[model samples]
Target: MTAALHGLLTGLTLIIAIGSQNVFVLRQGLRREHVLAVVLVCLASDVVLISAGASGLGALLRAAPQVVAAARWAGVAFLLGYAVLAARRALRGDGGGMEADARGTRTGRGAAVLTALALTWLNPHVYLDTVLLLGSVAASHGEQARLFALGAIGGSALWFTALGFGARRLGTFLRRPRAWRILDGAVAVTMLLVAGMLAAG
Candidate 1:
């Protein structure tokens, strides 16, 4: 495969994993809440990160061990906090059932946007996947690395669009409070596990 196609396939494969960002997007999509904004934020972040990676930012990051250390600690804290919130939501019987209540909405737009930002930016795996790994792979292409980055960007856009839009198809099964509780519980477990891995590494 060509470098661009390689990047596209690699990017899709990596991002398709059930990570924190995917879980957040899936929840927002199921709720039909700020889906567009969340998708845009995630897509934009992938663009910037992939571009930076292709441009040798990965080497820069390696040179600055302190930056990675700081980011690691911050990511651990943020992810653990998110895990707690998800656990609480599961326990409280909330975070599912997107149907309108007396108040018209359960989560506000600003909250959704903020959550999207945190999930995308604060996740250490994002940097590892988009920056170090993708960047290193692109470097093998010599001058075609830019094309590789573009391909990665395309994959990111396509995946997020599909994920955000395609998630609503599961609304029937996810309409119940019990379903929501299970989803949130899974999310909480994922967050905790990822955070623990980050801390240990």
Candidate 2:
């Protein structure tokens, strides 16, 4: 239970930030175009990635103490760097708000699914966050690693569900720079804490 909760929070903090994939999801939601398809694709992709990380990839790392140590430090460095970037975004209000893309003709379901797939699979950050960072963190839970991954998966489920289905209601607030500043500030703090925890371990 504890490990799961920790993973849930970690997943939320890592994923809640503004990014291309998220932006795409948000836009699809706002447009109300093949939202189910997009959301499903994203959720499926996450399941595969997170499962791989917590299982097969994690098993590989557990066999190598030196590799795990190096990866841990690397994760710490990455999280800290990300924290700094998020802090800058919070302070400077740069890349702070979602832009309103001009509404065009509704895209087909297949096209939307393809786009979601590309956004998720083709993005390097997704691999780093889901496979590497998340896997390392889950491994720290020891025997409860699967539970941790489950919780993280839950987080993704909740986030995508809310973001995709509730975009209409959230559109106005999400467009505000202040809202983004607050979100980014929280992200910065979360990243710092996660980085600290990894470093201590």
> Model 1: per-residue lDDT, tens digit, 22-100?
9889888888888999999999999999999999999998888777777778888988999999999899876765653
- Cα displacement (Å) at residue 126, model 1: 1.9
Instruction: Please give the lDDT score at residue 126 for candidate 2.
Output: 61
Off by over 4 Å in 2: 58-104, 170-201
Tell me the tens digit of each residue's lDDT in model 2 across 72-147. Answer: 6766676677678768978976533344234233467897798677656644456667877899899889999999
Q: Estimate each model's TM-score.
A: 0.93, 0.63
- Candidate 1 has its poorest 10 consecutive residues by lDDT at 96-105
Clashing pairs in 2: none
For every model shown, the clashing-pair count is 0, 0
Question: Which is the leading candidate under TM-score?
Answer: 1
lDDT of each: 0.86, 0.74
